[model samples]
Target chain A: MALTQEHIQQRLTEKFGDLVSNFETPYGMLSFEAPKDQNLKVLQFLYDEADLNFQFMTDLTAVNYPDKPGRELAVVYHLHNLRDNVRIRFTVYSDINSPDVFTASKLFSAANWMERETYDFFGVNFVGHENLKRILNVDEMDYFPLRKEYPLEERTRIDKDDQMFGRG
Target chain B: MTEHHQHHIKLPEGSIEKQTTTLNVGPTHPATHGVFQNIMELDGEQIVSTEQTVGYIHRAFEKLAERRPLYQITTLTDRLNYCSSPLNNMGWHLTCEKLLGVQTPKRVDYLRIIIMELSRISDHLICNSIMGVDTGAYTGFMYIMQYRELIYEIYEEICGSRLTTNIGRIGGFERNFTNTAFTKLEKFLKEYPAALRELENLFTRNRIFMERTIGTGPISAERALNYGFTGPNLRAAGVDYDVRVHSPYSSYEDFDFKVPVGKTGDSYDRFLVRNEEMWQSLSILNQAYKKVQEFKGAEAEVFHADVPEYYLPKKEDVYTKMESLIWHFKIVMGEVDMPKGEVYHSIEAGNGELGFYLVSDGGRTPFRLHFRRPSFIYYQAYPELVIGGMLSDAIVVMSSLNLIAGELDA
Candidate 1:
């Protein structure tokens, strides 16, 4: 049977004391918002101490909400522990100007590119990453494309005279 | 700890530094399988370091979904994993249906299972055939490609498009399974096993093929789990976690098939797992075809798919019925209402568990739609798989891993 949101919340409360702030969206997924400072520690506890061993980081991406101050960007992490067949969502919010968070690549090597992708798309700087660079787009591109404010159609077309190799 | 990246981070001063050459593998390369570019810093065929630059094929699908209605997203999903678009289409539609609390009829569920299983077979054929070609066994590749062509012919007979088949709508199939589809599929099922056996014999026994793949890129079950590997990649590591068996979506619980696993998680093991899975899929297909045939000539009840707002109308009745016409107009104009909710629906895709995470705000267009792509997850373990193996072995291992560039980049 799938883990009910209530069961998940009870389990979290039993394990983490008061660290977890739980909110249930109308959609049925339990959202657990933890402090950005205790992100890695809370994850370690969730994996090791509690049996919520979400060993697999299925996805790691970020969302940008510029209008919301103090919560301008959220680094969303989706985890699935195949052993118990349970899934969870862990999120850490950061400010827009200097969005830096600890890298989970230390815990799961699979987070290497996921963190880089989060960095590439949402511009959330992962502080302890060994190498963080653009993975999907050209490295020379100036801005994060997935951010809500990024202009998609502002790119100017190069003229024939400006082309170095001439028009095809 | 930092040996792989030291050369880029450190620099000796004004001394004449040697400038190494850079090789761009693809924005187009045969081995790449699609438009993906990898900028590699090469020291005479030994890669010092590599940077994979993807998204050349990113169609801004999220933006497109934002502009289009919920049901229209099915047409767009066909482009994501064209090799197995039916699975994606079903996943996307099921997510919406689940949000709407709609239950499809048993017949529709059976039809979905048949299409998705066939799609899985078609995808595995391509992955295994590509592995064969990468290992210099062209005969095996040709044989399986021929089988895949037959599968495509069946797909064409059913959906009108062989590759980009928008086979399913939001609630049920776009239309009922046609007679031509069943006949062609029955013929293919009869011949496909022999073709697969021939290809397996040709490649699995060849000494060169075995030598190239046997020990290349071996992964332990624990390591695979840590790396977030799923599907054949994980199954090859001795994990008995097939989504079809465990999650059992689309009435998959009704089928009887074995989840083939391997002791050693290597390229060779991956090959064995996929080959055996094709057999299991064939059995499942046979059963589905039988069940579908059993439902022939029944009085087609008014299509009970709950969300009439999203699913397409029947071509026969849309012209004559005023209510159908009005519903069609409402669907086209995005005036039909949907409840505000979110849903995550997944299925056993050819590669692994393909999930569609959808958020709807009672609007025609989805507020957010996220794809959990198997290739994207598997590719994260690429360096670990590729580093210890030789360059030639890297290519073979990559093929066996079935990392589709379209799904990865999207």
Candidate 2:
């Protein structure tokens, strides 16, 4: 029997029923969201389970959603099972006031820098990471640039003419 | 009195501790081949620990993409991995096409394959030759660079620029390939094999090169996976996973090729794997060219897709026709609305699986766009690979990994 999205979803729901929600297959990929605290549990189960061994951490990133009151930051994990050639996306939401998610660096060594990058840009703190500092940005930067609060352009720059830039 | 003092001061063997010296490789060094720093702590000549700092060339591309139109984002991808700019361009276009639900013609897919393979060859050529240069063998570097120049000429004939070739559009190519481009490609196919043979003869079995590279920076297959290794680096670690093979896109399934794998996952294995892949790319290029030639008349003339609102009109049409002029204005201004959905599309870039994860809220610009750079992923393991190794071996390991600073800090 081939590994399909339904099989993986069923296994996940059976283990942690109702804990994993918002299960949707967008463009044929299985994506779901879980609580921020249970991130390591879900990752461990996916890795240790015989049929669903998603050992390869394809990517780890964070998306900021300021409109959502409680869940302002969403840390997404893309995992791939090489044996079955299947992929699943898992996300965990964190509050803006205290954005802390458990570190997956112990499980996947690749998560070390990725978590730091997420912290650098989106300010999503990965608790228990050995070196949880900015990876790509200058350490002197006081604010997270990727957060929705900041504007894309430099606020201090006044030399540019708005009429020439089509803003007029 | 002096003899008594000396006898009294007799110390135990190994009492003195070895002092570790801290050395900075570069924010600008010749061996690093890019602007990045590696703070290495060394005990004598052996590396004890290493800390890396990137972001010297950080341009905030993702932030910029949030403001720019979809078509304008193609220019940003050019600077990501300049060695394989066309691959990035095609990957971005494929992502946009997926979001728009557009299907490109067969001829366009074949043309894309030819250009992409040529870019892949150029990328691997630079890496392998630079590996030779780092090993103190400059002849192979000089000999192989000429082929890279030829590939650039092919790019020039296809697109206007050579290095940063923004070669394609959303649905397909901006223009059809000219006859001169075909002639140049044919010449390249005929002459490159012999040049490659000579270049390989110089480095492949050379005892000095082998001794310098083999077992110098060996990463186990399991650890390589844990560190998110992909492309030639992961293949060198004995993993037979290629994005082109695993998830076929852009008509990759139509062609036949082999995914070269290596054992030991050392610098030597990486070099050999890249060399083998260049051969496979050449084979794929030949097959794609023949398949493209099979299309005749109207089929060959069709470069862009049938989607008028997305693809820009030709300059002549835009100048003469009112409807074309309006469509051109709308497309350039990003007034054309697309479906509201999120999509993650990846392509087999020269370095690895270069992916674009896009979130759309049915707006002119993307809600969020993220580039999954393989260089950024693989470079995190540098500290682990270099620890407990000789200082010189660190350089070999860095080169074999082919860490493009642009992609790393983007």
Candidate 3:
């Protein structure tokens, strides 16, 4: 039988039971959220299962929600099954204070740099990653640039006044 | 007491301690072709281990996208892969159209197809010729660069810019293709194939070139998939997956073409795969041009969608008409609100899958935008690829991968 979104969802719900929640089919793709600690278990199950083989890590990124107090960061994983050509998105949320998610670098080698990028931008600390330092930004950067806390433009520039640019 | 303790330090017998010298290839080497640094630990001419450092040209495009309006962000996409800027422009436009729920006409899609394939040809030409140049053959590089000049002329005729072409609008092109553009494209189509054949004869079977590239940097199919390789690189590893075939966005399903594959994912295989793809692109271009010419009288002039709120108005209409003036002002100022949703759309860029993962909250700009650049993902495996190979092989591998610094660091 060809793998469908419902089959994948059903398998996930059966394996993890109530651990996986927030099931959604946004734009005809299966998306769901898991606990931050259970990320590796979910990824391993998805990789090992014959009927639900999503081995290809298409993309890995994070979105910051400053308003959500307990869950301020969401790490999204896009996995693809080459045999079936089906894609599913898995997400895990963590608090901003102690944002530690298990690394998938051991399973998917592509996750090494992507996880480092996520850590560099959003400060999502992948616990077991071998080299979880900054990937893109300069080594001297003190703050995570992609988080919602910082403003887009530099506030320290003295040459241009805000009144001249119509901001004031 | 210290002198007595250091009196007899024993050395192991017959240990031929060899020194491995560390070399920094570039943030600006001629053969690097981009601003990227490769730190290699070398034992004589062979690389013992390698480390890569990118982001020298990083401008943080994703962060910039949050502050700019939708139309203004197209300029960012152009800089990502400047060699094939039209592809990035078209990919972003398609994503926005999906969000706006706009359906483009068949003629518009065909025109886009023609320009995209031309860009693909130009991109592959640069990659293949540069590979030749790296291997100490300058004739083929000079021979093929002239065709890229022709392709750039076609781009100029369409968008008034050659390299960083912010060519098309959200719904469609800014204007219809001129007769002069078509004439130039015709001339290109007639001449490029012979130049391509000549280029192939120079390197495909040449003994030295084959020895340099055939098994220089090899990646298996399973490993390539695990490392998130796509486009020509992945296809060269014997995986027949293509975004055009798998996802079928932007009327690619209507066209008929073959996805080429190679058994061994080596430098030579990558070169062959890209060469075969250029032929397929030419075939697609021919078909698209024929289909575009079939549109009749009034239909032929329709370049953009009918949605005035999203598409920009002409300068004359904006000056004279009332509604056009207001719409122009609103669009330029980005006062029009977008829908509340998230969408991920990808296109098969010259390098790989160039994806736009957008999250909007019905605001003037995106809440979050992530550009899934293929170069960023593929460059991750470079250190592992060149670890045990010769130093010369490292240069060849880098050229074959065709890492664009802008895309890599974006």
Candidate 4:
């Protein structure tokens, strides 16, 4: 039998107490928010515990909310348990000043590159990564591209007279 | 030298010398089906490390999908992995269908299974044959390529474009399986077994081919799982998991086939797994052909078929009926309200678990979409797989892993 959202909420609340926060959308999905410090604990439990072995980290992405004051960025992790075919989403919020979150690389090695991609696009720092460098775009890039505030249109105009020309 | 210096650092006495060499294998190389680059660090004939730099074929698909209407994204899905775009398109449509809470008819489901399995056969054929080509087995490559051509011909008969076929619609297929497609597929089905047998007999037991692939790039099942390996890569590691059997989307449940697993987790085992899977796909095609032949109908949905909100409203209906005209205008103007929710739908795409996770916030476009691509995961394990193998064998390892650069970069 598949565990419903209610069972997930009850089990999580009973296990972790106030460390977890449940956000219920109008849709049936229950977005579970755990404290940044407890992210790994929550993930490990989800993987090891009965009825919630979310062995697969389906996707990892970061969303930027520039308008939001306290929480300026959110890193979302979507996980799935192949056994029961159950899925759950976990998110952690951080502000721009020190936008840092625990890395799940130790739990799932696949998160290494994915977390780096998220960091490259959204600038959310995965604190424990050994080599936290940009994976997709070139280095020395000034800004994160995927943030809502960053316009997709090119913001910089090329200067015709800036570069040295080929000489005879 | 001092005792401390001897333990920490040392250098051999030699005259200062500089050596420079470079090798470019991409952008037009036959091995690279799409635009891809690999800059290799070399020490003479041996490669030190290879840096794969992609995105040359970057259509900016994710950004394009955000800007375009839901249906328009289907065209972009065609660009994700052009060799097997039908499966990618089906994955996108199935996600949308899940969001709409709509199900396709049983016949349409069978058609989807048949086409997708055919595409899988073609993809595996390319991977296996390309491995042979890279390993200098030209005859095997030609034999498999011949069969692949037959599959593409069948595809062209069904859809105008053979490579980038935007075949599946939001709720069902754009059209039924054409009679020509069915006949050609049936013919190919009968002949593919013999061709596959010939290739198998030639390569599977060949001493040279075995030495090139067997025990090369060996990865245990535990390591494969840790690295998030899927598709035949995971199967080669002795996992008995196939999304078709586990998830059973479309009419996969109705199909009678076996999920072939491997004993030794190596490139050779992966090759054997895909070889067995080809025969299994042939069985599926044969069964679907028999089932499709027995059916006698218009070959598509009837009442809900004319869904003006989702599908295109017919010209005749629009001219004759006011409601049809109004709904048509609404749909055309992008005023129809889609439900605000997220749907995660997956299918056993040719490679592996090709999942499309779409979050539609009651708008004309999805708020967020994610593709659970298989190559992306498998490529993450590339360094681990090829670290100890010879430089020449990297190509064979890559081919056995079936790393499609388009899908990986996308």
Candidate 5:
């Protein structure tokens, strides 16, 4: 049987029951958020559940929502159940201050580099990541460049200018 | 340090020991091809382990996308997978269309399929021929390179750029496919199969080539899935999951083509899978072209969908008409505001699933855009792939993975 959105929603609601909330079908994709602490449990359930085998990790990345205070960083995981050709969006929010989330590397090895990249840009600290220094930016880069506070380099800006950083 | 970049060792602390010799595959070496490289720890000829480092040419495209308007970001997507840039271009456009809830005409989708398949052929040709070169067969590389140029000529005819073609707009093609482009497509369809078959004979049947690649760098289907493998790499492992088939983007469902699979996912399996995919792409291209030729009268003349608000105006139209001038100016200057939506769209890029995840806040620019680059994802398994293999086999497997640095770093 093909996996439908309601089936996925029911499976999640039954398994975790309100632990996952904001169940929405954004652009025909089942999207919901799990508690930051229970991310792995949710992932494990979604994986181990024979009918809900979303084993394939399509993408892993974080979005910096500057307006949201406690939930500043939204770490989004796009998972695919290849058996049923069904896709769902699983997200967990973390505070920019703490930004600690459980790493999915243990479950999905693909999450290793992606988590590093997410750390490199958004400063979303994976609490147990094996090596979480930097992936794309220089190691000495003190600030996460993708955060909304550090706007993209512009000629009009006077504070922290390019010449000050030796980029000029 | 010339000692395999001690600065770039990404391995865990205790994994590397003192006995094995460390060899640099490349950040610039000719054999590695792209800017990314791996530091292999070899016990004589056998690779004990590898630590790979990437992002030497990091352009911060995702960060840059935060400020640019929707249409302006096409140029950024163009730089992702330069080998099959039109695929990236089309992928971005489709993402934008999905977010905007714009339905593209069937004719537009067919035209896009034609361009996309041509790009797939070009990309797979370069990769397969490069694999041949790595296996010490240089003649096959040179033999099929001209056919790749023919594919490029087709791209040139349509988009006026050989590489990094920002081919189509959000709605559809900037203009209709010209007669020259169609002529070039016909020429490619006529000549490429024979060349491809001979290229196959040169590598597939040769005993040396078979021996070198047959069991080298094999991965099981389970491990590949765990490591987020897709495209020909995953299919080479015998899982026939293709984005085109599974998701059916841009009217891919309208046509019928087989998704080729291979057992014992190795360099040879990857090579065979890519070669077969090229044949299937050719068949799709033929069907799309024929479907395009079937459009008649008013339907034939239509190119871009009737989304003037998003589609860029023709140069002549912008020059002549005042309304066209305003819309063009508005689009170019980032005055148009996109609807608030989150959309993830991926296409079957030549390498694998090249996905674009866009989140909009009903602003002039995207709040966030992430490229689910297949090169970045699948290339993570390189260390696992090269472990316990001969040092020489690492080079062939790397080329077989077809990691384009532009996409990898992005």
Candidate 6:
């Protein structure tokens, strides 16, 4: 039997019970948020459950939401089930100051470098990561470059009308 | 030197013996084919362990995509896995289409499949032939280079430029496929198979090639999945988890093709799997072309959809129609208001699942855009694959993985 969105929600809701919240099917993909601390527990449950096995870690990256004060960094995990051909988006948010979450590298080796990249960009420190040093940027680099504060350009050009573009 | 020093440090009588040699295979080594460092600890000729350092070619594509509008980001996608850039280009367009709910016509879909499969063939040809070159057989590369050139000529006919061809727009192609393009496609279809067969014969059954790659750098299906392997590398590990089959995109469902699988997950199996995939891609390309030819009259002329907001207006239309002139100005400036949505669209590129996770804040530019690059994910498993293997075999493993540094460090 193919896994349905309802079945996944039911199983997750039954296990996580009020822990996992914000269940949504944006663009027909099951998206939900788990508390930053209990991320591994939710992932392990999803992995161990025969019916809801999302073993393939398709992608792991971080998103920085400058507007949100408390929940500033969101680490998004795109997981896939090859047998059933189903994919789900799992997300967890942490404060920018204490952006520490348990690393999924123990369960998925794919998360090792991905988490490091997340750290490199959005500065989501994956707690318990074996080698969490800067992967992309140089070791001497101080600030995270992908943060919203860092503008791509200074925008000093006076040639074109800024109102013509969306920035106005 | 063995005597214990009391207060003062004594100089060693002889140089200290280092057991293992740390070898840097590349940030620029020819075997790597791109810029990325692999620090391998070796005991004589056998690898003890290896650590990889990427980002030498990091252009910060993801960072750049945040500020640019939809059409402007297409060029960035092209530079990712430039071997099959059309695949990434289409994937980005498809992601935007999904977010905006813009459906493309069947003719457009079929044409995209043809272009995509051609790029796939070219990419696989390069990878498989490079594997042969690494394993002491350079003749296969020589035989297949001309055929790859023929595929590029077809791209040139469609889009004007060859490599990094920003071929397709959001809804469909920039223009209709010309007669010259079809003739070039026919030429490629007629001639590529024989050359591909010859390249196969040069490497597949050769005893030396087989012995060199058969047992080197083998990974199990379980390990491959854990390491997030996909495309030919995962298939070579005896898993048939192709993105085309698993998640159909760009009317891939309309075409018929076989997903080739391999056992033992070694360099040789990877080579064979890629070769077979190229054949399947060719078959699919032929089927798509036949389907495209079946369209007649007005249906044949439909290159792009009726997306007045997105698609650029022609020069004549801009001159005559007032709305067309305004839309053209707006489109050029990238000022169209896009609906807010988060969409993850992936396509089966030459390598694996090239996923685009896009987040829109109801603005012209995307709030967040992440490319789930296969090269980046595959490179993570390199150390595990080549550990304890011969150094020469590691080169074969690298080529077989087909890790492009542009995509890897994106």
Error of 6 at B311 (Å): 1.3
lDDT of 3 by residue, B58-159 (tens): 898999898666898899999998889999999999999988899998888899999899999998889999999999999999989889999999999999
Q: Where does candidate 6 stray beyond 4 Å?
A: A155-164, B1-18, B319-321
> Looking at candidate 4, what is the lDDT of residue A96?
73
Tell me the lDDT of model 6 at B336: 92
**Native interface contacts retained, candidate 6:** 0.85
Q: 1 or 5: which has the higher lDDT?
A: 5
- Identify the candidate with maximal TM-score: 2
Clashing pairs in 4: none
Q: Tens digits of per-residue lDDT for model 3 on A1-168?
A: 889888898999999999999998766678999999999999999999999999999999999989899899999999999899998889999999999999999999999999999999999999999999998898889999999888777879878674553334
Off by over 4 Å in 4: A1-8, A23-31, A65-69, A153-168, B1-33, B38-50, B298-306, B314-333
**Location of the lowest summed lDDT over 10 successive residues in candidate 6 chain A:** A157-166
Give a tens-digit lDDT track for model 4, residues A27-58: 34467787777888888988888787788777
For each candidate, what TM-score against the reference?
Answer: 0.88, 0.96, 0.95, 0.87, 0.94, 0.95
Residue-level lDDT tens digits of model 2 in A116-158: 9999999998999999999888999999998878987677987
Count of backbone collisions within predicted model 6? 0
Better of 3 and 6 by DockQ: 6
Give me the runs in candidate 1 sitting further than 4 Å from their true place.
Answer: A1-7, A25-28, A65-67, A151-168, B1-24, B39-49, B296-306, B320-322
lDDT tens digits, residues A92-168, model 1?
89988879899888888778878887888778899899989977777898888777676434547444332332211
Model 4: what TM-score?
Answer: 0.87
lDDT of 6 by residue, B1-410 (tens): 69986898677977767699999999999999999999999999999999999999888888888888888899999999989888888888899899988899999999999998999998999999999889888888987899989988988888888889988888998889999999999999998888888888898999999999999999999999999988999999999988888788878888788999999999999999999999998899899999999999999999998988898887799999998899888886678978987789898888898999998888888899999999898789998899989999999999999999889988
Residue A22, model 1: lDDT of: 57
Top-scoring candidate (DockQ): 6
Chain A of model 6, TM-score against the native? 0.93
Q: Per-residue alpha-carbon lDDT of model 2 for B1-410, expressed as tens digits?
A: 55554346778999998698999999999999998899999999999999999999999998888767798899999999988999999999999998999999989999999999999999999999999999999999998888899999989988889988988888888888999999999999999999999989999999999988999788889999999999999999999999999988999999999999999999999999999999999999999999999888888797878999799888899999999999998888788776887788899999999999888878778878999999999999998888999998899899999999989988
**Candidate 1, which CAPRI tier?**
acceptable
